[model samples]
Target: MLQKTYDSQICSLARALELVGERWSLLIVRDALFAGVTRFNDFQHNLGIATNVLASRLEAFVDAGIMERREVHGSPRQHTYALTAKGRDLAPTLVALTSWGDRWATDGEPPILFHHADCGAAVGVETTCARCGAVGHDGVQVAPGPGMPAEYLADRRPARPPQP
Candidate 1:
């Protein structure tokens, strides 16, 4: 678990909230990626998210490196949204969350079932380390990588000044 400093708590949640915690953000990611709806009008028509809110969410998503804006030719000077590599990395997170929701939230069975398109069998999801064959929760631990915050630098001093 993350440390309980006020700033850490707020920042941690805010970072994730920018993607999934908002009213329509995850749905936006879902539609853009899975449903193949790209245009502003298509999202509006499909999700019914208010115009202003959708605009704000799109801008936020772009700023967070989750989506990129690209020019749309032969149109009235509008742009389209595309996923970034970092954004595409969220695929596993989305899939795990969706699977958990399918298991626990639905009343009877999962309303939707995911099958292997090639083999045509019901599938269960699991996470395994490619480096090691261990297949348990203890086998998985998160460590900061190149994208981590500057304070994560090993040479940095501990008990640093509080952030605002």
Candidate 2:
């Protein structure tokens, strides 16, 4: 297990990371979203995660309001975990991360592709400007928002050089 880092930063990204930064956390979420896994045994079987680790992750998820646990009606030891609305909102984030891995980490064609189930069209993830509809990584810039910490403002990077 990796030691948790505490950031005194006020950024939303930082806060979000505090909850999901653990190594197995987001992978667990990914399994729940993409593989429809719910039971503890299923998560254990599919992920091969240690029992204590899985239990800790599940308990953290439940505490964070990302997932809700329900007891099996007739079973004492069986429970199902389901994503709450807040958890479902992470689908796009997972898609974005997966797309990044597919592009930069793969040797050839991607092993898996995402598609719309309704129309069966392949889907790609990109950041788009809401104002101009300009797409891709280069079209956006980050500015200091109201919530930005003063330390960050004082020690910011120069504007990135254009990609070749």
Candidate 3:
């Protein structure tokens, strides 16, 4: 069985999960990205997260290179967290997750909307094929790639016989 920690997995997704898979981690990133929340008090006020948990999550983010902590206002005491380039790169992932939630989880209209900064038009995440243009979930297929471990390949169920 695959471990919940996924330490043995060689997949990129597994590696990413290790960094920001905790419940509060992505929300912290979301606030940093969309709400411009930086300070510990601001995060606590916005998220209502406990002090110790928030501190630990922030430290993990900093250690993972997703955020940087720096002193605020040249005061050796006060500090703020800022997203690094790696953290900003999670925008699309968050957007996609938001889109899905808005579709299937919400009761009424979406509580928040995303807009294109340049045109001020609503935007959403979509899957597009490089050569064939847009595609839906049914149009996508997974196959073993060069990065697939031999053990993973062996564990995969045998391909079904071709339909008659």
Using lDDT, give the best candidate's number: 3
Residue pairs in collision within model 1: none
The residue pairs in collision within model 3 are none
- Give the true-structure RMSD of model 3: 2.8
Q: lDDT of all the models against the reference?
A: 0.75, 0.86, 0.92
Worst 10 residues of 3 by lDDT: 1-10
Ten contiguous residues minimizing lDDT sum, candidate 2: 1-10
Model 2 Cα RMSD, 1 decimal: 3.0
Ranking by TM-score: 3, 2, 1
**Overall local distance difference test of candidate 3:** 0.92
* lDDT by residue for model 3 (66-159), tens: 9999998878999999999999999999999999999999999999899999999988889999999999987887677898888888887977
After the best TM-score superposition of candidate 1, give how far the Cα of residue 98 lies from its true spot, in angstroms.
0.8
Write the number of the candidate with greater TM-score, choosing between 2 and 3: 3
Off-target runs (Cα >4 Å) in candidate 1 are 1-6, 10-14, 115-124, 129-164
Residue 17 lDDT (model 3): 87
Q: Compute each candidate's TM-score over C-alphas.
A: 0.67, 0.84, 0.89
> How badly does each model clash, as a count of residue pairs?
0, 0, 0
TM-score of candidate 1 to 2 decimals: 0.67
Model 1: lDDT equals: 0.75
